[model samples]
Target: MTDDLDTPVLDNHLHLDPRHGRGVDAVKDFVRLGGTHLLVVNKPSWHLGVEPDEPTDFRPVFEETLDAVAAANEVLPGRAWPVLGVHPGLISRLVDDRGFSPEDARDLMQGGIEVASEFVADGDALALKSGRPHYDVSDAVWAASNAVTRRAFELGAALDCAVQLHTEASEDLTDLAAAAEEVGLDPTRVVKHYAEGRLAGLTPSVMSEKDRLERAAESGEPFLMETDYVDDPEKPGMVLGPKTVPRRVRWLLEAGYDDAVRRAHVETPRAVYEIDTESTLNRDT
Candidate 1:
């Protein structure tokens, strides 16, 4: 077990699929490691399937993921939140493998955005996740995917929820704030998930690596940390483990960077997700 810290850490992004056989045990382990909060994301390819015969419907997957979050809260109430949306890669998968026409693929994405909005409006989710940029796709598919992402931003703006982006690591987001402004969404509410370097005016939920986390800390930028933990048995802790953020917090504390630790694990999450761990924990108690 990792040594506990005085302050609690939040893993802002993680995949807690039961298929991996890491259900309540995973949540219990995380709490033991001093992880106080988690943002569980739904990836259709992970839960459902990529093939046509498999259930292509997204609603069930979304609901099931939400249920997973609620179940985690039952085990550790107010400690887990949900993020629901259609992955940007799913758009290309439908067009290329499933033989969905570009128009149909876009329409499906639009439908996903609508469902995501409904989930947020109903308080089932903390944010809307979309806008993964695929650089290798044909220009037509690329444009269509981006249009779907833009629509997600528009819906998030209308409903007052944040939109998390899953884009290429090298992609520049200098225009993200301006684009969001044009669509009536606050720039700060647009999160760049699995991010690396700092964007000019965007919030990044950065991957937990020593070098990356150190740089982000030294830069004194406002950011959140995530392991992007896939929780696949085959690839156990693919990106990083569930305990990553808390371990990083221990490192920060040892290095005497208390303020940075608090900002990354506490302040930024509260500001972005509008969640207060202390208050939630108090209520739970």
Candidate 2:
């Protein structure tokens, strides 16, 4: 795939586990296939072999994620930035395996996001990742997870950065949008990661797929595209391939989606993450 596109091709949600996956090579695959920017989100604590008993325990998790981002940037400078925080699924582990109460688990997760906010505050990262568990769970656990998500929104507001949410597959974010508003964050700044496009009241970082892209493009509502590439060797190309975003961009362009492509890749990201992705890619090129 040629990298001759005029606008930047950005993958909004990606993970690079150097220990157990293609890691930087996966990122290289994206860059080689015309991807110009990546928001490298942190994998779960357990994925990196960390069992957090306290908030500071997440330090290693964030550090290693940042290391992976650094490694990616070393090879492809100005291409990757981090979105660090505890994965919401870890709450199940904390309450089930680690023997913590639901409330404690929720607080721990919030604390983890708070720790992550320090990196954003220091300007080491661009966004924060947090959300409730996508799978089924008890009511108490669900409540706790929602609380953690709200804490993430509050932190995002304080840092004046975006929050990338990994939640259930639902288009209605009415409640979450209200929570963000309640916390003094602009609801538009909250991105629903792994989103199905045309979300009710927030930015949808829709997964890169033909039909989904078509619908999102036709809707005329601003949205971003992502591969959500997990980069796991065992489950290689789990969610989507690393090159999916750039490849889809090409497909959309061929289908005469120039305005949609520009809106998704450049306008939405600049408005949400406050990054000049197109200009940044232009300068780097």
The most accurate candidate by lDDT is 2
Residue pairs whose backbone atoms clash in candidate 2: none
Worst 10-residue stretch by lDDT in candidate 2?
276-285
Model 2 lDDT per residue over 116-188, tens place: 9999999998999999888999999999999999999999999899999999999898899999999999989
The alpha-carbon RMSD values of the candidates against the true structure, listed in the order shown, are 2.5, 1.4
Q: Summing lDDT over every window of 10 consecutive residues in candidate 1, give the lowest-scoring window.
A: 46-55
Q: What's the lDDT for all of these models?
A: 0.77, 0.89
> Could you give me the TM-score of model 2 versus the true structure?
0.96
Q: State which candidate has the highest TM-score.
A: 2
Write candidate 1's Cα lDDT for 1-285 as tens digits: 534567767888888777555866777777767777788988655346533323235677788788789878865533788998888888777888779987788888878778767888998888988875546888788778778888888998898888888877753686666778889988888889888846665798888887777777887878888988876777877789877787888887887778878888778878877878766753232
User: For model 1, how big is the CA root-mean-square deviation?
Assistant: 2.5
> After superposition, which runs of candidate 1 have C-alpha atoms over 4 Å from their true positions?
1-3, 50-56, 282-285
